[model samples]
Target: MKKNLLYVTFVNLVNGFAGIAFIPLALKSLGTEGYGLYSIFVILVSYIYFVEMGVAKYFTRTIAQASNVSEEQKIMRSATGMYIRITLLLFIITPILFFIIPKWVFPTNNHGLVSIIVIFASLDYLLSIPPTIKLTYNLGKEEFEHISKFNLISGLSKHLFLIGSVLIFKSVILLIITVLLRRVFDILYAKKFLKSMPKGSWQPQYAKGEFKKIFSQSIVLSMAQLTQITILSIGTFLINRNFTMKEVGIYKATFDLASKVSFFSNSLGMVVFPRFSSVLKRTEEKISLLNKMPLYYKISWLVYSILFLISLVIIPIIPNILNIQDMELFYLLLYGACLNAHANLSYEFLQADARLKEVIIPSIITLLMMSVIFYLTLDYYSFYAIGISWVLSQVFNSMCMDTMVLRKIRKSSSITTICFNLIISIGVIILYLSLGVY
Candidate 1:
């Protein structure tokens, strides 16, 4: 567990730094409008992968709980077949959606560039399916060291390609092609690693009963994941619809910078999730871990607070560095990120415990509230509308998850932590409002 945590932490740190490094170069090379187009491509590719619908999580839990090697192989075979079908479905459906959705979503943008990006993005995701399934299998097996090593290499190589694409090719089309090729390499690399595992056929082996069982078990998880992705995607969707490509670029860049704070919670959650699933049948052990959740929340809050302070110190200079004009947007989004940092572990625990409705219901409520807030404030606040809605909705969502959902697990201590964090967040908001930045 300690080694896994260390490996995952280092991987996230490297990836985080790479992301931070890429932004400035991308902005310099692509310019704002070009970067906005790249962001659209990235976002669309992520949406395409949503077809997995939490099957990966379901498989991870089942594979982790498997009492024998044969059981594990059975799960892997079923997963491989399911993903193959998903990839084929994507091949058919993605192009049609890409053709229609991009144009509709960004009516004012360049249709030609959109078409190019959509084409490559769809291909990128399709090629990624196999490697993604293999990675999920490794994750279930708690092969964190190998997975992290692969991710480190893959991430470093990807950014190198991305940086090269921008600096050398300076074409969005070439940059996207570079991304597609990276996934091709990832599958080959993943295949080589899979060879070292227990001997079994890696080919697709369709098992209808297994597929139905996994889907039924993970359906609520799928809904929760869909809501989560929609919440993340809606900001980009709204910004693209209402603003210029340049504004979209600025929002995405700032959002990415602010969201780096989440690596702390996300890294910890990833390390703990498999362990949680492995021990799912042990009530006392699970409850003991549940009792420690408040401590986890506190640790997350401390990291968020530290990062928030650091962001304040560096916020002024970021505009000069990134050539962005608005620091207020970063501040608003940072608050949302902080809330996410606090709530992420609790959310993960609920999923690990199969308390899916507790997770999904609050997410649904948050999504509706965020949309309403965006609708009401967009005309008046412009780009700030996205930040405003995100922070406020996150506040409500964090409160719900920490208090209501944690209570379902009989952890009342989390409610106190939630109240304290809420107070701090509210105080920070009031302080930001006093500056009149918005």
Candidate 2:
């Protein structure tokens, strides 16, 4: 687990650096408007994938279960083959949906060439299977170091690849190609890396029925995933409809920076989830998990809080770095980061227990509510309308998750301390806000 998370965190940091590393270049190359158009392409792609319904995510859990009794090699081979077929089908169908969904999902686009590019980019799902299988093995068994090393190798490779591609090719197509290739390479390497581990016979049998059962579950698991996709792109949908692509661009940059930084907590969560799942309902396991969760929450809170504040420091310099001056955009990012931290702490358990519906139902309701509110309020005021709804959405979702999680772990930890901390934090935040952010 140590290696898995450390490697992931390092690579994530690298990816974060790589993004900022290239932003100045991409800013110069794409210009703000072109960058905004590209952001639209990405947002559309994200929306399409989100509508996919969480199948890819279910592979980890199902494959873990399958691995319990099945031979390791057999599990890997069968899972890998099944993953490939489904990913191919998904990639093939994405373009058709890309063309069709915009009719309903959005009014419209320059998706002509970009649609194909996005579709191609989406195919990374196929290449992700082998590493996923390998990683899940480590996760299920608590051998996180193995997974961590693999990620470190691949993440660095990807970072270099991204940087090199941008410097040399400088096209969105090239960037996508680099990303896809890196994933493909990671899967291949991971598959080979697992060869020396426990040996089980490799069976080539199609096992069509078994694979079908797994796939069915995966589809259900994707609902929570789809909720997230909606959240990520829903902002873009509004910005594009009510404002200009340029507004989308500013929003995209703000969200992207926030999302990338926020990704660290995800790794910590990933390492924790399987361990959490592996625990039994006994007081012992709950005690262990409970002791660990707050520590996890504290680590997440501190990391995100520090990063959030640092982003504040960096925001002023970002205009100089990327040559686009929008302080309010960074403000949006900082707010989003705070929300990201709180929301993640709220939902980490939901993912661990495979209770995405617990996570999804609230998120979906809040999303619909926020969307309606934003749409209504946006007519009078634009971005501020979106921000108000965004903050409320996060607050509602976080509180919901917090209430549920605290209930589950209340016997194990200090609710009073948590409540007091929350109250104090809110007071300080309000004071800071009232003082007027510099």
Candidate 3:
């Protein structure tokens, strides 16, 4: 576990540097409108990739709990088959979407460029299925070091390639193609690793019963995933629909900057999820781990709070650095990201324990609330409406999940801790609104 955490940390660190370089470079090469188009393309692909429907998480949990090698093989085979079918479906759907989405979503943009980029990006995602399934299997087995090394190589290479390619070519289409080529390397590495494991073919083999079982177990998780994606993407979606592409670029850039803080929570969740899955049936162990949830929250809160302070110093400078406007979006989004990090582990814990409904319910409510807020405030707040909705909804969602998690283990609710974080979050918002610091 220690080694896994260390490797993940190193991977995220390198990728963090890559991210720091990638965005400003992208902005320089693509310009604000071009970058906005690219962001929309990426978000569209994410929505399409929802076809995955939580199969990866399902495989991870089942494989972790599997008692024997044969069982693991069966799980992998079903997963491979499921992925293949999904890939085929994407082949048919991607073209149709590329045609319709640009016209409907961004009628003013270049449809030709958007279509070409979306097609290549969709293909990149399609080609990634095999490698992703294999890597997910490794995750299920707690082979984090192996997976982290793969991520380190894949992530760093992709970013470096994008940074250099955009500098030279200044083409979003080329960037998509670059990502597709990088997947070839990923597939090779995942295949090599799978060969050393116990005998199991990568060939797709469908077992109707197994497929149904996996889907049934994963559907709730899929709902949770879809809702989460909607919540995150809604801001970009709304900004693009009702405002200028330049605003879309600014919002996405600031959101990306704030999202970096989530690296800690994301890495921690990755390491602990398998542990949570493995102990699902063990009451005492589950309780013991649940008892540690507050420590996890505090660690996450501390990291977020520290970054929140640093952001106060840095946020004002980002507009000049990135040559973008509306720097204030960073603060509200940072607060949203912090609230997200606080509840991230609890979400993972619930998912691993197959209590996904608890996770999905808050997410659904948050999405509805976000939509209502966006509707009511868009005329008054513009892009700031998106930020306000996200922060408020995240606060509600985080508290609910944390409280639910504590209740699951028969522990007293950490209302004090929850309230403390809530107070700080609210205070930050008040400060931002009253002082109007940008």
Q: Which has the greatest TM-score?
A: 1
For lDDT, candidate 2 versus 3, the one ahead is 3
lDDT of each: 0.79, 0.62, 0.78
Q: Residues 272-355, candidate 1, lDDT per residue (tens digit)?
A: 788888776798887777677667666666677667766666666445665553678888888898887778877877788888
**Number of backbone collisions per candidate:** 0, 5, 0
Candidate 3 deviant stretches above 4 angstroms: 105-107, 192-195, 314-324, 409-412, 430-437
The CA lDDT at 349 in model 2 is 67
Superposed by TM-score, candidate 2 places the C-alpha of residue 94 at a distance from the truth, in angstroms, of 3.1
Q: Between 1 and 2, whose TM-score is larger?
A: 1
Error of 1 at 349 (Å): 1.0
C-alpha RMSD values across all candidates: 2.2, 3.7, 2.4
Worst 10 residues of 2 by lDDT: 195-204
Q: Order the candidates by lDDT, highest first.
A: 1, 3, 2
lDDT of 1 at 62: 81
